[model samples]
Target: MKSKLFDYVERDNLVFHLSGVTKLICFICLTFSVMFSYDIRVILSVMILSLIFFKVSGLEWKQIKLMVIYVIVFLLINFVLTFIFSPQYGVEIYGTKHEIYRFNSRYTITLEQLLYQITKLTKYASVVPLGLIFLLTTNPSELAASMNRIGLNYKAAYALSLTLRYFPDLIRNYQDISLAQQSRGLDLSKKEKLGVRIKNIMNICVPLIFSTLDRIELISNAMDLRGFGKHKKRTWYASKRLKRQDYIAILIAVFVLVGSICISVFINRSRFYNPFI
Candidate 1:
């Protein structure tokens, strides 16, 4: 049977033509843009741009549906909880509040808090696409090569690559184990209480842990037999030499960094939004 867990996200798409460093630089730009602003307009703009890139990357809609669902659920839960518990959170951002509802002297809902929550949600949404882009577009081997080019040790780079490579394997293993247990009389799918489900998952975890350890030992032995890591510098079959694309990638990163710094200074000095208040 095909393993679902280690199923590498492969695509013969345009994104693959961009060197790993280029994708990495783009990721850093998007991340900084998300984190460096509390402005909802900026965040939303970044998000929209990221979505355009996602389309350009040629990722299947069906493959990303689960991630989309998770993001929506996370945003909903975050905003709901923040509003319920800290509706006065807008005091930090707006320096004032417009009361929406007053339950008591200590409990109230305000426009400021609601807007603050929305801004926070927008920030998260901005970063989510970039995170997904990095994960979906970069292959494990290429990512390792990028890391190595950036002066990381081969061992460390390869370990990082292996971790990414094995994630799908681990997920597939868990699913197979769960299925086997279910076929043998486990009822994990039942709508039991949350606590019961937790207990059942724990039960599954024990065997999964042992199985993973055995697999690890087998892999280690095989590597040792093949003289893995014996050399001071191991050659990589998949590693690529840095080219013109990599230089352009680094140049882009420098431009983004400089631009963000300049914009931040301008905003702080001019206080452009001060006139609105």
Candidate 2:
């Protein structure tokens, strides 16, 4: 199938047929589970499971490569800053410190710190894939319809749909505008100095922003002509009811969430599992 402006949601696969609302619901449960629990084992399992699901969905790594790279860089930055500022944060949280190295009066490395940071990274690793899976495997129109099905106002649902559709379009428009700028003698190539390349991009960004605004106005006018949001409720031509697979998926997600909460509260006696104790 041809890629749309909403290319993330335009893919075809077994997961593509699942109800959008079900994916959102299950994703929420899984995300919450990962976020609330600090167990390394649980976090690792969730991360592995999410990657397996992503593989099963038949999405190409090439399609999501840039986004994954951005996430990884952000996470790495967080990791470095955590060590720079709060070197003892994990020790404090875990209530135990086995010092691996003492750098100075204020800076020391500990095994507890390593484990804490790993768990933190694992939390991010698990959640990012779940979010990517939802965005890439579900249809945007169906997602909007699912929002409306679950009691969100039609206006809000429509707005959400437009936002989802707008991002990919914006990127496409940026590329087109950059090419036009290049034709007009702007040099944005890597051969240019960093400062010059930035200036070239700024030149491209100005017209791209204007173009985006014009397209937004056009969409608004078209919707106005069609009498969008004239009714409190709207029908969705593409929406599907929850299916057996969707139910099973949702149940599994909920079970994971509840199980994490129970283990954290009852077994671990806290969100953090202190092996050092």
Candidate 3:
């Protein structure tokens, strides 16, 4: 069977070959660099790097298309809601207003608002590629080992690994359940109204939930039988020593993060880049 979306893809590439600990650190640094900086330049730089990483990881577009669409839809809704709730938020931040369009006394679009919103959108959209690359390349077992290496409790790290592994399984299970239901005469096709389609899809949840619960029970029982967590320490089959490339990657991520913050403080002079000035 084909690998499900978000499933780890084994590839002999730089991104894939990096230590999971390195990837986790790079992800945090790069993601935070984007998240903490309001400067469009910094956001776009990280975004471009993320895209380059994604390309190097050999991840196909098909693997991430559904998730990209979902993120875009969610971002659009969030932007619309932000605009409706705080039309002059940008003006307040920049201390200047260049009206682009006036919808009403309360709802007016300005160059500041547009730029602000665009920056916010880009900031968020930038993280997706990096996150996808990390998720699609890192093995959960390795990630758990990495987490434990970083001083996290082995049990918590193992639980997180299980959670990461569970997500792909859950998605696969949901797809299987959905297909079976559709084969049994449920109409989830586009011909159904949106409401009807959603209603039909929700019907799969009951079985999915029950199956998931059963899976949890089985896992817990197996772990108990194996005496999991009975030891103060456990060896990891996937543990790997950090390589030179891992150090380089982590340092590059740290540099990017520090560079972004430095630019914000010394050059931009504030978190919010004021282009109107």
lDDT of 1 by residue, 1-277 (tens): 4343334577776666667767777788767866776656656767887788778877766556667888999999998888778767676556776787898876688777766777789888878777777876788888887777767887788788888888777877788888888788766766778788888888788899999899889988987899977886666566666567667755754565555555556764421122225
Q: Is candidate 1 or candidate 3 better by lDDT?
A: 3
Clashing pairs in 3: none
User: Once model 1 is optimally superposed onto the true structure by TM-score, how far is the C-alpha of residue 183 displaced, in angstroms?
Assistant: 1.7
TM-score for each of the candidates: 0.83, 0.95, 0.94
Report RMSD (Å) for each prediction in the order shown.
3.2, 2.0, 1.7
Q: Where does the lowest 10-residue lDDT sum fall in candidate 1?
A: 268-277
**Clashing pairs in model 1, backbone N/Cα/C closer than 3 A:** 5-168, 6-168, 6-169
Error at 162, model 3, angstroms: 1.1
Model 3: residues with Cα > 4 Å off, grouped in runs: 1-3, 192-199
Tell me the tens digit of each residue's lDDT in model 3 across 82-142. Answer: 8999899999999999998998999999999998999999998999998898888999999
